[model samples]
Target: MLRIADKTFNSRLLLGSGKFASPQLMQQAVAASNCQLVTLALKRLELDKPQDDLLSPLKAMNVQLLPNTSGAKTAKEAVFAAELAREALQTHWLKLEIHPDARYLMPDPIETLLAAEQLVKRGFVVLPYCSADPVLCKRLEQVGCAAVMPLGAAIGSNQGLQTRAMLEIIIEQATVPVIIDAGLGAPSHAAAAMELGAAAVLVNTAIASSDNPVAMAHAFALAVEAGHSAFTAGLAHHNNQAIASSPFTDFLAAL
Candidate 1:
């Protein structure tokens, strides 16, 4: 079971509710993925509306709604967004992301850390989407974030684990869950992230943009299980030279 804060989830796959062709398709993808947690951008939500089209199905599925500060460019703006989300969703769980760079959408470590500290104090279960920097991840953990979501690559880039070395360090050092987020484009990528000992992975573009999103979501779910199972089963050691699986005894040599 994947445990974060006070919540324990059966599935380690986390889905982002964005970029789908329709709300129905998104729902299908979510159901196929079997993710217990789904992230919804605060900017996309209609907080004033009684029944939001986007939120209703997810609520019906009984999945945890994780409100995110996706468009916020500063710490103050993120805190404000977090407050709105808490009131709107009636949940203190939040995914704090502050990216000032329009082109790359690289998360600002400073702003993320600042926002995490403030939100934690306000009793929100903060999960900051941050750069693949070990020091920054450690600092975010120190600030009482429920989990650290370090990027594998740029947001929606589908580059896949560009910061593998840094991610390894972050996973090795993290006291809280280390969720690999962003730029994972395939089931294999998700599997690789899980094999690296990540607590979970947050995927958006890869599944949503796929030709068969529902099938792709299922593929990713299987990959996550396989990878985690492999990790738990323990992988074989890497060797420079090949070693024979069976010994070549003198009796076999006589033949």
Candidate 2:
């Protein structure tokens, strides 16, 4: 189980409720993926509506809600968005993401850290989305973030772990969970992340955008399990020299 801020989740695969063809399909995908945590951007939710069409179905799914501050460019704005999500969604858990740049959709380390600090102070279970910087991850963990979400690549780009080296460092040093978020194009990518010892991953565009969302979600779930199993089984390390399974002398003796 992955523990984060008083919650224990059995599934390491977290799903994002965005870019899906329909809310029903998203629900089906979530069901198929068997993800315990699902991310929904606060900016996308209709807070004013009592029964938001998109949110109602998600609520029925009974999975843990992870409301994100996606559009907030500053710490203050992010905090406000988090509060609104808490009130509307009835959950204090938040995925803190502050990206001022529209082109790359790169998370602002300064703003993210600041927002995480504030949210933690306010009794919110904060999971901050940040760059794959070892030092920055430590800083967020120090500020009481439940988990550090480092991008595999640019958000929604489906690039797949461009910052693999940095992610390894973050996972090695992080006291809290390290969740690989963004830029995972396929189940293989998610599996690769798990194989690298990531505690969890948040996937959105890949499964949602696939032609068969439910089937794709199942593939991702299986991949995550397989990767975790491989990690736990202790994969062999790389080496330049290869040793023969049976020595020549041993074979001759058998003969």
Global fold similarity of model 1 (TM-score) = 0.95
lDDT of 1 by residue, 112-158 (tens): 99999999999999999999999999999998999999999999999
lDDT of 2 by residue, 1-255 (tens): 889889898999999989888778999999999998999875554678665377776678778999999889999999999999999789999999999999999999999999999999999999999999999999999989999999999998999999999999999999999999999999999999999999999999999989998999999999999888888898888889987777557556666
Task: Write down the worst ten-residue block by lDDT for model 2.
Answer: 43-52
Question: What is the TM-score (0 to 1) of candidate 2?
Answer: 0.93
Q: Which candidate gets the maximum TM-score versus the true structure?
A: 1
Local error of candidate 2 at residue 44 (angstroms) = 7.6
The global C-alpha lDDT for each of the candidates, from Candidate 1 onward, is 0.95, 0.92
The residue pairs that clash in candidate 2, if any, are none
RMSD of each: 2.1, 2.5
TM-score for all models, in order of appearance: 0.95, 0.93
